[model samples]
Structures are given as structure tokens and as C-alpha cells.
Target: MSEATDYSRETENLDNCDVEAAYARWAPIYDLTFTAVFRPGRRALTAAANKADGPILDVGVGTGLELPMFEPHTEVYGVDLSEHMLRRAAQRVERERLSHVVGLYKMDASRMAFPDAAFACVCAPFVLTVVPEPEAMLDELARVVRPGGEIILVNHVSRKDDPLAALDTWLDRHVAPKLGWRPQFPWSIIGDWIDQRSDMELMERRLLAPFGLFTMSRIRRLPLSQDVDAPVMPAELEYA
Candidate 1:
């Protein structure tokens, strides 16, 4: 194959095999291996959900880890791209008798089936880097959430100045192939994308504990206005 074709095929194979297969293999040991790493973000997301009004959507709700944390009265829905993960999430709902969990679906975050303005709050935890097209997924989230709705994100952001930056880069280059995640995902690209959008207003940003490896952000979707500037894509970053 030509170099371009080879790269394309490799990317296709990675997309088809990486996410679902990796999660399927990890499903059995996921809680044991990742629960501690993800717990802080899950806690922050659920805390935000408890305070938000109306129904909430948990995007990338892997194994329903945050499902039980939601208040019993809050109506919550969850969606994940991996059927194996969604099945586990469904089982958790049943095992825990979580009455607040409205539904779980196998759905792509980039092209969600939800109707417009369906949720009051959208939470994406440790998911942005996993998706094939993070920008498209963010647009889908914006579309499904009501005006003035909150969007909460908790994910690891790469910092070039961090002491562990070199280690993170090395892992992204070497270990990511086996682990199936981009450990050194570019935070600058995501930041620039969010900054260019007129509809999204950054409300708060805080570094999560235990070495500040992750960041939690609270952003509000502004109500549509005629005066709002048309969203212009940043030329420096390509959606992937």
C-alpha cells in the first residue's frame, strides 16, 4: 500500500478495533484497574448533576460508574459507543436498583440520537480523547442540551511544562497502541476549539487532586441570539 493508503487503513483498523475491543477486554478488570483513577472526576460530575435541574445525560458512561452517585430523584440517561460497556452499565443499574437511571443506550457520541435540547446537563468524563472526533462530539452535546444548560468535562489535559510531560509523551507514542487511548492528547486543540465557539462560555476550571493530572470544567451554553457571531473553525487544529 502507498504510505497515504497505509495510514488510512491503519487508522480505520484502529478505530474499528481499538475502542470496543479494548473496552471489552478491559471490562472485566476495568473497575479494579481504573476506578481509582476515574473516581474523582465521576464524583465531580455526579455532584454537578445533583444540582442541575431537569434531566441529565452522561456521555461515555462506561460501566455506569457514576450512575449510583446521582441523586435518587435526578432523572439520568447514559450513552456509550461500546456495547460491552453499555451492557455492563445496564447490569449495574439493575444490580443497584438505581431508579434514577432513566435509560442506557449504545450510541455514538459524535452523532447522538437524542432530540434537540433534550438534557439540562451533559457530562463527559474521561472521554474526549477516546472519541474519533472530539469536536463533532462537542457539537452533538451542544445540540442536545438546552440553552443555558451546563456541560461538564473531566479529562486529562496535556501540559508541555508539566514535569511528567515527557513520560506522558513517551506513553502516548508507545503504550497507547496497546492501551487504546491517547495519553498525551493535545489540550491546546480542545481549548482553542472551545474558545472559538460563541455558544459556549467557560464558567470554571479546576485541577483535580493527587498531582493535577486531570481537569474539571464547567461551561454553560448561551442562549441563541441573532447578534452572536457565526462560529468559525480554528485553522490550526483539525477535527479527528
Candidate 2:
């Protein structure tokens, strides 16, 4: 096959692997390969999560990975697009005897099934980078969270300090495609989307070990006319 034909074929194959199928394909080896690779994200995410309030929603909560980090008094809900991953998550919840403290659902993160203001906090670790269209997911997250609620995120982003940002761009375009993660958009830009709207406030930024980054933000979806006094920050979440 010609190089162009090969590329097209690969893209087509990746497009067919939805969350359920992709995750199911990786299920058996998922923990073994991803556990150590994601340690940075877990540590950073837990620190950010520590600041969020109870009644948390873990969107794209694959395999109940965040269960142990949840506070004992807090009620947690895990949602994912994969039944297989949700099953694993459910098993973990049962094993931990957290049936009373946790709930599980099979759902899409881009179109959340929950009601507006349904959760005090929303979290997703290492999920946004893999999502097909992250903006849609962010919009959904913004819509359902309560005012002053937090959106905690932990992600392995393309390093910003790389000279020319070439490595990051190349990884997104080439390496990520092979993994079925569309690299059309770099991962570092997530904060820009979160802070651009008037409803969210960037609260904290921390560097996770081994190169992950975490952000803790508060939501305030009211129109600008309603909150003329709100502060604004640069894309870096840096404020004067």
C-alpha cells in the first residue's frame, strides 16, 4: 500500500475503536503497563482532589482508579463509556467494601447524563488527552457543576519548555495517532479552555512527578454581567 493509503487505513481503524472496544482490548494488560506510567498523574490528581468537596463525579472514571483517593465522608460516582472498565471499577468498589460510598454508571463524558449542579466537584485523571473532542467534554463538565464547585484534572501533557515545542507537536501528530489518541490538539492547552470562559477560576497549579500537571479550578457559570467582579488570568493560570 502507498504511504497515504497506509495512513488512511490506520486512521479508519482507530476511529472504529470506541472507548469500550479500545479499553476492552487493553483490559488485561492495562493495569500492568499503565500503572507505573500513570503514577505521576495519580499523585498530582490526588493532591488536587483533596481540595474538592463531597459528592464528587469522576467523569471517565476508568477502572475505579481514583477510588482510594476519595475521602471517607464523600460520596463518589464513577462514569465511563466502557462497560468492561465499569465492571472492573465495580469489582474494585466491592472489594474495598465501598458499595455504600460509591456508585457506578456506564455513560459518555462528552454528553453527561447528570443534572445541572448535580455534583460538588468533577474530576478526570489522564482522560482528557484521550478524549476525541475535549472541548465538548469541557462544556459538559462546565454545565453540570455547581457554582464555586471544583474541576480537578491531572494529565500527562507535552512539555511546554521543549525548545520550539517540536517534540510535543510531533508526538501529538504521530505517536498519539498510533495509540488511537487523536493528536490534532496538544494536551497542554486544556487550561486555556477552562479559563477562557467566565464561569471557571483557576485556583491551583502543581507539577506531578515524572512530568504530569494538575490543575484545580472553580466553576461559576453565570454570565459576565452577573459576575462583573470576577478575576481573569492568562492561559498559564498566572495572575498578578
Candidate 3:
């Protein structure tokens, strides 16, 4: 096929395929390959979960790597779009006898079935960029988490000034379809979205290990009474 036609076909496939199919292929060897690189973020998430008040919701809980790390007394629920990944997670839960893991459902993060304020904390680890609609997923997370609850995210955010930025962008555009991740996704997308909301408070943003490509963010949901009309951050400041 011509180069343009090949590119068009690839884009079409990416749009049509659900994340599950991509992850299904990766599930079997995911832990072996990514466990080391993602260790710091997973540890941070576990620490956050241990300190959180009530039940926890782990969105995009691929292979349940962090499930066993949660405190034994903390009740944890996990959801993911990939059944194959969830199956691996289920096996881990059983093998480890991690009773703290209350559930592992195969569900889309953009439209979680849970009711409002269903959880005390909602976390998405290395997940934001992988979803089809990250804004919708965040909104759903906010809806399910209690007013005073925490929302944690651990993901890689592209930096325009980074030396690897150009290469990352090229890889994201050319290789992400086969690799199942958007390596060049910008932090501005989430930052801009969050800046317009009045319902959450930004608690922290810290870089993780492995060259600081990844970051961990903590946000606390404000009570309904605190909701207010706030001015959006300036375009230049959105990614700052």
C-alpha cells in the first residue's frame, strides 16, 4: 500500500479497536516487561491508598500489580477495559490471597457503573493517556469519589522542552497504534481540564523515577457547596 494509504488504515484501526484488544496481547507479559519501569509509581499509589480514608477504586488496574501492596484492611475495587488483563489480575488476587481486593470488574473507565460518591478514593495509574476519553474518565472518577475524597493519578506527561520530546512525538504518532500507548501525550490536556473545575483541589504533583518522565498527582474533591465559577487558566499557563 502507498504510505498515505497505510497511515490512513492504521489510524482507522486505532479508532475502531477498543483498548482491550491491544491489552489482551500485552497481558501475559506485561508484568515482566513493565514491572521495573513502573515500580515507583505503583509504590506511590500504594502509599496513597494506605493513607486514604475508606474504600478505594483503582481504575485501569492492569494485572493488579498494586493490589497486593494496599493495606490488608483497606477494601479495594479495581476496573479495567481488558478482560485478559483482568484475568491476570484475578489470578494474582487469588494467588496472593489478597482479600483487600474486593472486586475486579471489566468495565470502561469513561462510563463507570458506580453511583455518586461510591468510593473514598479513586486512582488511575499509568492510565490517563491510554483511555479514549480521559476527560470523561476523570469526570466519572470525580463523580464516584466522595466530596472530600482523594483522586490519584500516575502517568507520563510529555514536556516540550525535553531533549527526547521530538522523538517521543514521532513514536507516539507512528508506533503507538502497535504499542498500545500514547508516548507523547501532553500534560496540558489534563492540566487545562482541571483548571476549569471548581470541585477539586490540587494537592501535589511530583515526578517519579526513571528520568522523571512520569508524574504522580493528588487531587482532593471539594464539597458541592464549595463549587464556584472559576476563571480558566491562561493557555500559556495551562502546562506550566
Q: Rate the local accuracy (lDDT) of all candidates.
A: 0.80, 0.64, 0.82
Deviation in angstroms for 160 in model 2?
4.0
Q: Give the worst 10-residue stretch by lDDT in candidate 3.
A: 1-10
Each model's backbone clash number? 1, 1, 0
Q: What lDDT is obtained when candidate 3 is compared to the true structure?
A: 0.82
Q: Which candidate model has the greater lDDT, 2 or 3?
A: 3
Off by over 4 Å in 2: 1-16, 162-171, 175-178, 182-188, 212-226, 229-240
Candidate 3, residues 102-219: lDDT per residue as tens digits? 8887677877778899999999999998886778888989899998899999999888777789888898878776777777778777787788778888889898988887989898
In candidate 1, what are the lDDT values of residues 63-162, reduced to their tens digit?
Answer: 8898899999899988887767777788888878998987887677877778999999999998888876778878988889888888999888887777
Error of 2 at 38 (Å): 1.8
Q: What is the lDDT of residue 209 in candidate 3?
A: 88
- Which residue pairs show backbone clashes in model 1? 132-240
User: What does candidate 2's lDDT look like per residue over 13-70, in tens digits?
Assistant: 2443554567876666677777776766766666565666657888877776667767
Displacement of residue 125 (Cα, Å) in model 3 is 0.3
Q: Candidate 3: which stretches are off by over 4 Å?
A: 1-18, 229-240
Lowest summed lDDT across 10 adjacent residues in model 2 is found at 1-10
Q: By lDDT, is 1 or 3 better?
A: 3
| Candidate number of the best lDDT | 3
